[model samples]
Target chain A: MRTRSVVAYKGPSGASVEIVKQTFSSARPKPARRVSFLAGLHGDELEGVYLCFLLVQYLRRLKETEPGAFLGEVNVYPAVNPQALCHGSRLWPFFSVDMNRLMGEPAGNSLPAGACRELLADLKGCSDLAVDLHSSNQHLAELPQIRIVKDFEKKLLPLALQCNVDVIWVHPMAGVFESTLGYNLNRAKVPTLVMELGICLRIHRDFCSQILDGAIHLLHHAGVLNSSRRPRGEIKMPLVLKADQVGLVQAKRAGLFAGRVKLGDRVGKGDKIGDVVDPVRGETLEEVVSPFKGTIFTLRELPLIYEGAPLVRVALDGPDER
Target chain B: MGEAVSLYKNVWEKGHFVDTLSIVAGLHGDHLNGLHLVSLLSRFLQDVEDGRLPGFRIAGKIQLFPMVNIQAVMEGERLWSFDNLDLDLAFPGSSCGELADRLCNVLYKHTADSNYALLLDASEKRCVSIPHIQLLQPDRSLRRAARYLAGEIPGGGPDRFPGLGIVRELQPTPAFQLRLYNQWIENNVCALVLAGGRSAGIDPETNGALLANVVNFMLAVGVLAHATRKAEKGEARFYSLENERRVSASHPGLFLPEARVGESLRQGRKLGELRDIYSGETLEELFAPQDGLLLTLRDYPLVYQNETVATLLVEKERRWYWPFS
Candidate 1:
């Protein structure tokens, strides 16, 4: 096990922040391939951080029991935005800038920009495959899923299928995704999978363990783990959905939202999903309904919602629907 | 019924209205300085149209968009409170997209025919800046127009346009590509951003200065005619990206700034001090690294470690063939 500081910056007083990466490599002179696991890009999203922790723990045990089983290398960057993670905020505290949106740009003395550049430089050319894990924000709980841009869909879908996620959504490209780490890495010809699971600031143990199993399976598939030490598990095939196959339910009035449908629950069209009620007036402002016969993959966890806030996201039923 | 994002353009037209000058403000709802400045301009233009101002007249066409992000302004937020999306970053926008996107598209289309555009912008939230013109990824023609507006050209005298003597040229970052200023420039409109004051509020002094700057820009661009004063020739100080220095806090604590924006300072001058948040003990004193003008000062007292507290615009030194030069 080797830990290295990829980037360090001095604070105004004297304190320093460093982004560190831990690597576990095999004893063989030349291993099969290297895999990189990254989490905590947004400080608030902690599920991925716990998943990385689980992987680290499992790898440590494997190295202790049979060191030769670690065939290639596994690099874990558990916390990419250390300051944000420390502050428990979604953006870097200093600049309030999203580090994920600053990738592939010139590092021009700004702390967040420089940190992103340094992290990208460190990750590039260091691994054969990479997984950038994230979680939904405080408002919504997302099912374990992999979102791939249509541009990189062909390259990422096969690898995403190995991750045991509930869905593999291939969406069209937007300008906002251009600066993302996943987009930049894929553009550089290094295939990267972006896994989003659960909600921010909370850990779902079952979800973490499920993804951990898939990650280990991926390590073996990538030749990072020896065949003899391959983990046995059934990898679930994910429902592949296009951008238009998803239905979004938004609040029509500002009020308290009471969600009736749970995540992963299948519902028919016009099903009562939730209601926005004005407590002061003792009136139901709006009753939200499923737009199509589909499975609810994302549901709003927080009750207080604005008029246009998204309440639920459903994977619509179709020929491709499982 | 869906609420529409409506835009109101106050236009003043006169003889030979071939050249059009567009002035925009309130792209971010919280940035009140620009909104006030543009409102003042609108009133001034109305006065000119009414023949109230004896010496000033509308020579060409001038369009004033006093409140671009009306919804945000109404909500007292920097972005649209509904979606928290920045209208400024959704330029060349989608007509069929969200409210922000549709608003941006309408604004872009309305301003497409402008020969010159000036955006009155407030500085970032929790920060105040001296009134200055910012040119992002400026081409040769745009630079020439900015120089003219700043009174840097040979015909326009220096100090003629008070509060706009400083011109900063910046290289647009990747995220800047979506900004309205960048999009306008790409479409051949000579556009510049005048940033000052702070967000969510208005400062009379900063707004007054920005108003004068915009009026002068209109005058320079031949959109407004002045019969009394003759144009004088002088220089406008120009700074590149390297000239700006950002000073950040070393520790998370209460930041008390001793220096104000637009103040001239010598090397090693005290800029601010940082104290512990809980104990209130003085942790560090920030000092200027060189002789320059303090362009921006953080207005917020509570700052996290490594957050920028101030930015200084260092004066450029002329060099000769000598070794020191």
Candidate 2:
């Protein structure tokens, strides 16, 4: 595996800040199909970063065991927000701008500018495929999913769907989606898919491993590696849930919240997901309830509470858009 | 609901669109929002584009074009541009002003005509907040209507909505626009009413509902009687100009969200728990410390305790100014 660092910024520290890019299967290339993965643009979202690291390690070991494991080349930029990681944060320091949004902007134009020009140029040179890894900052958790821009299904869906995540988001140029590195590559006509796996803040071991498995599956599925991985079952595409129907119940008064729900429970209207109480005062302030009928996918585990803080999330079936 | 225009009348490349626009007087690109709303409202657009959006001559009322800010929209930003000239602030723009100012001038021209209502429809950027409609009354009836509009709309009214402790200071403040809408009402007076569904980038259904609220409001205020548009369920509240609330991550650490948008809670509810990436020591617990409706929760976790996680559209029945009696 080849790991090269692309300088993104030259700081007051005199040393240039570089994004580490790692590659597998470059030695005996066969009509090299370069599939690239990037992660950790937002300092706080860490799951994708873990996946990046795991995949790199996995590829390293696989290349040795089975030469075929090193089919086409896979490049990984494990940590894009090194500054954030250095401080244990999500966004690039000082700029605080979401780096994902900075993708595609010309080098040295914006805040940190597009200092990744040479790296991006090389990425364009390998315009076969690209994947940007990510996760929700907070308030949402789910099985790994893929977001593909509109009309790329024919060329990219098969590649994207192979990741083995639960849902596939099909849309045109969403906010973070459009400015993402994957999107920028796609704009250059490189087939691209954005993989969102697990939550941020920490690594969900199973979720993290899921991504590792997905990368290998992708290599096999792409015909680069002749692996025995099989499609588990018929792929399922979930219906998109709008933002509003999803609800969060925060506490009205302050207390310790003891949630009585798991991560993925079905929630109906008026479900008691948790409660807020003053332990010392020996009185309850409010009980978090689901206002609309939906399924509960994530619940806050923290006990110490405030007057108003989110406790539970419910995804409801929605009405017409307008 | 959004339209695109090239300020620079001629074709220009990305390299010099800015300096070039200044010279030749035009730039290209579209400033857009309401994507999630529009995608969700594909059916609604089918109605509008397919001629199903029925509207008759407003007797003598006027209709203005929507203003688009391409530059700001491109960067996935809410503000006007990198320099930050809000579309509202740059209104009534000078001929030689910046692109934002120029667009503002364009807006002033379309809206300058007397007797026009401005329904500024928007959404919370994250998710799980009330859909709000605002109206600032012109005393008595408008005041009553502002209250009523505030109450009638899903979220809150033109001004003085509960959730937003932060607000935009502009000429057509909700009441100002409300006054504009009712300018021809003679006795009713004009006012401003803003209704928001899902905030930017997240909830499409709520966003669609918010847009529908405006359309329904237009139908009602336009008094297209018997329009058959079902009234929305929630009431609109009001807030002051000083009440704009912003949401971001909490604790500058990785934001591992324990929930999705629109979760319910009691006071002292845990929104999510933050921990150090290496040490695993619990840092801060994101909690709801008040009684209210949550407007936004993080869709992406990675927070800084001070970072705005989720915002609540707080409504204390009495403390709030209920326009609808």
Top candidate (DockQ): 1
Per-residue lDDT tens digits of candidate 2, residues B1-325?
Answer: 0123343211212232111100000011121233443333344433554456674212123232332555655665556443333353333455444345556565444444433244444543333334444444344444433332332323533331233222222223211222223332332335453434433434443344445544444334543222354332234234433333334333455556664433444666666776665667776677676655555565444443344667654444324343232
The residue pairs found clashing in candidate 1 are A11-B250, A12-B249, A12-B250, A13-B250, B30-B200, B157-B232, B157-B233, B157-B234, B158-B234
Name model 2 segments beyond 4 Å from true.
A8-10, A26-29, A116-119, A138-140, A149-156, A171-177, A228-259, A275-286, A291-295, A298-322, B1-325
Tell me the tens digit of each residue's lDDT in model 1 across B1-325. Answer: 2344589889988866379988898888888887788778888889988989899988899988889889888887676655435677677887655456767888899897799998888886688876677887666666666655553222222222134567788676656777888888888888988887777777765565545556766777788889975333224567887788888776767889998787888999999899876677998999998898888898978775666788888866521111110
Query: Model 1: runs farther than 4 Å from truth?
Result: A10-13, A227-229, A249-257, A276-287, A303-308, A319-322, B1-22, B28-32, B49-51, B55-115, B124-128, B152-163, B197-203, B220-239, B242-325
DockQ of each: 0.20, 0.01
TM-score of chain A of 1: 0.96
The alpha-carbon interface RMSD of model 1 comes to: 5.5
Q: Write candidate 1's Cα lDDT for A186-219 as tens digits.
A: 8888789999999999999988988998899888
Residue B243, candidate 1: Cα error in Å is: 5.8
| Docking category of candidate 1 | incorrect
Can you give the lDDT of residue B46 in candidate 2? Answer: 39
**Per-model i-RMS:** 5.5, 18.6
Candidate 1, residue A214: lDDT: 89
| For model 1 chain A, the run of ten residues with the poorest summed lDDT | A8-17
RMSD vs true structure, all candidates: 5.5, 22.5
Residue B77 lDDT in candidate 1: 65
**lDDT by residue for model 2 (A1-322), tens:** 7768764444422235677888675445464577778787776678888888787777766677765645577778787778877766655664444565556654423334444455567677754777778876553455566767666666776776677665565655433344557767777898877777666677888877766777777766775666443435443344344344456565665567878876657777777877787777677767777776655544665565444445765555564211
